[model samples]
Target: MSPTTLTDSSRVLCPETQSPQTARPKVTTVMVKTPRVAAISLDYVLYIESAKNGPLSRRQGLSPIKWEKIVPSPRPAPMEADIVSFTWPRFQTEAILHLANQRKALQAFLFKNLVEGNLLWLAYIKDHCDYGLAVQIHGATDFLNFSNAVYNAFPARVAVKITMDNLTHLAYEEAMRAHFQHHRQIAKAIKSIRVHASVTSLTSLTVVHPDHPQQVMEVLTKDLPEWAEAIVANHPKVTTRMPPQTTNFVWVDGRKRPTTHPLDAPPSKHNTGPEFTTPRNRTAATEPCSSPSDVDDIEVIQISSGTAATSNHTKPMAPASPELESHHMETYIHVAHIHKGDKLTWARLLNHGIVHWLFFRSSSKVELIGLGFPIGIA
Candidate 1:
């Protein structure tokens, strides 16, 4: 038999005539590749476990938060005048106007922010008081106006207050003393001193003697030739026995002398110290007191430019030590960077292990890259 004639046609038979044979569709498999780009957002969280260990794990996180915006509002206008709501009577309008005018000029001078302005304002106010202007205004108001005027005239006075406390006080006292001396010299230099007709306007020079009565008497008698002998007498000392509780001294021209008021005078001599004595309330054998010699250095600083008034005495500051200078030196740092996705992943490789195979259809195949520092290291 021939090979062509031996073929079996039974294998190519129809399904209906065959013994229940089944057929399935053909299937194919393929592989695909694509380029991926990555970028670092420049935001990072540092977990420093140890300096040597560095970052153990890093995972991508959310972006940083931004600052809120600010909106500004316009300022309100100043009130010019209120007729019905007046603080002072309209009759004193002239004086008010004068004061207002003076205030404007003073304000301009104060705006200069100079020490001299503060001194000038202080001196002017002190002179105003010396000339018996105290009765025109309340004492508290006078002090406030004097203080405010000087501060306004020279804002830089604040700096002086901060830098040199001692020098400033000394300067203030010296200025006041000089002012007193100048008035006396001017009176003598002119030879004829015009006395104001009104007793209220008279210049009353008061000399206070806390310690040496003899010295105070001599200063009044010798230095003030303008004053009479009666005007140079010592202030009468008051004892606990005396009837009057308080003493008053009257200043006539350049002299200040104590006068007695029969009704207000005490009876007789009494001890200088307090009367009552108890274990808890008893006085110390030696009272706490400061001697003039104890002071090391005196510095006069000008706090206000518009007035000559000064602050009470203050202690001097000590020099800065070497340890303080060393402590002032501190260290800091600033960092900046720009990174691409691939570079970011490469930088994060040590913290996050290498990526395995990836699939486009499934999200499980995706991996996250992290970048961070070790905790407590930086």
Candidate 2:
């Protein structure tokens, strides 16, 4: 015969002890390996077992009794909210507007895309903090004003793609053909509004999708050859050339300067190291420290763009000139794309910028085919 199926059941009963410390409800679990028999009283036997271990000792074949304290389950923690909202900074948007206004091909791309309905504009404002890039999503429903949309979104400093072949794209192409027939010279027509009249010529203005890695690398190779070479060689130090005027675009290992010696000599003491010129005053002298007490007699010479320190005994160093200040300031190259999208949110855009997204699209409604950001050449 097959082994009898065993089942376990538990029930709580009032405490038999009058002691307040032992007043917790008694719990008894029954493990019955055999079918119910009329000769045995299961409830009475369980009650006797719960009161003491005497019943277990008396019953020749009874299972040993066990006592366990009940523990409550813990509640789960709350989840974080995914949605976040923010306004696109005005300066970044302004830079994009400037690029669109300056470049005919860019304006035409924006115009044609705006007319078609779906546009995804992505831009990397190199100056916009350390954040990488931001993408603005526009659906067909909000194509009323092209320039306004661009200023609200951003410009294309990297690459722009047109993925639609619908009536709008065709109409724009036909208009471009008529302009080409009228002007004859492609160069002259490209300089005017006719530049935006066609979507066919956009390839020349910006790198097309699926062709970014090669094109972006080509631009980087030409503009910042040292960086490109270092990236390919996987070298820590790039000794061939100085970094571009822009700093912090990417980390170049072994670029950290050696610890500088303190240059905190009193006004009377002269610097023995190389003499550096102050850009503002055209005087040659070593840089000073904010606090003289920090350093002993050692010299501390710093090479950076900032306001010079002042001393009660020594005259204040000249401030940076306007041109120098502007040169040190951050500049950016933005890349814009035209694509399809529906639901868009500010949180999604912020997240896109934060994650250093190489080539990923989060919008469920949009398909990103091409993206390009040419390394900005000063």
Candidate 3:
């Protein structure tokens, strides 16, 4: 009739039923923490050589070294031609492709899959490309979109030099100013402008029209920060150019508006998406419903949500096959270290779109140098 007592080693026995009961130790669950990936920027310098043009070479080199020195002869091709003649479409294509591949590789390294929110900016000190057609075509916009999807994502900005040659016609200068002014009417804009004049022209022109010199000078110098600030006081979106150093000006511009969080209550509602949040612990363990695969393979982990919080603890339910894993990871061979001597070859490559290919291949290297960002991360 005694009640049963259970101890560490003793089993329980029921008096009437003659049944034994055992106790099991409590199981402790532990959650391993995954480190969050840090954001980074990548920078690069594409030192392309000038193309061969017998006449232009003589003009740029043989002409008076000083901007002020008088040259009775007609000026040769503009300085712009001398600096970026080698960066042709073909070369750009090659560079772009190289960057694209590098981007893919880097995405895999960090997330174990390709997630397109990487930010990348292109910097060219004296490049004269009409526009970044190469970058746009490859995936620059896509990169921007991905960054915008995440609040912490940094927007990429392209920096380059705008020279006298970039102004195709003397008449276009007025139009460029008007166009810039239009942007100013909408928002505060920062622009870098550079003015170049032969020393003789600077001195003689200033003297000839001292009162209105800054006006003509303003036409050439409008994009400078000092000038931009003056304009911005009136027009929030003023475009000012930075002063020229060595007749060369490198400036940064916000090609797109700076990104803002919804919580911040920005003036513009251009960003299109739900407010972003740090991906914490919201991931689903099942395969993404949108994915094509249902095999539950190691290579294909289902991402229930795009939030980073969900991604932290999420793991592929199954391990990937050896071949599948190997294919996902690739190695980039450093084909060459572009140097001053290789300028001629680079020039030729630029003309052929091979430069673009090279750019793609060396994207990681260039990003490291140009923007201080890892190529893969961007």
Q: For each candidate, how many residue pairs have backbone atoms clashing (under 3 Å)?
A: 42, 12, 56
lDDT by residue (1-378, candidate 1, tens digit) is 565563575345566765764797689776432222111011111112122222221222333222111111121222132211222223123222332244553233223322332211112322333421222222345544543443333321110010112334566798999888767654553232112111111122223233432222111122233332122232244211111112232212222223222122243311111132334443333323645554333333332323243222434234332222111011001111212333543444333332211110111111120023222211
Give the per-residue lDDT digits (tens) of candidate 3, residues 1-378: 256656645663656776576898899987542232322222222111124223222345544431221111332221111112123333233333333344553223223211332222333211323332323223544443322322132122223211112223434687788878867743443322222332121212111122333222212222234444545556443333323232323222212222222223342322212233334454433455646553343243332343222233334244332222221001111223344454554454344332122233222333222322233422
- In model 1, where do residues sit more than 4 Å from their true spots? 7-23, 31-35, 40-43, 47-378
On lDDT, the leading prediction is 3
**lDDT of each model, Cα atoms only?**
0.27, 0.30, 0.31
What order do candidates take by TM-score, descending? 3, 2, 1
Of 2 and 3, the candidate ahead on TM-score is 3
Worst 10 residues of 2 by lDDT: 37-46
Stronger candidate by TM-score (1 vs 2): 2
lDDT of 2 by residue, 152-236 (tens): 3333122212222343445669889987665444333233322222222223122111322221101132233333334344456
- Superposition TM-score, candidate 2 onto the true structure: 0.12
Q: Rank by lDDT, highest first.
A: 3, 2, 1
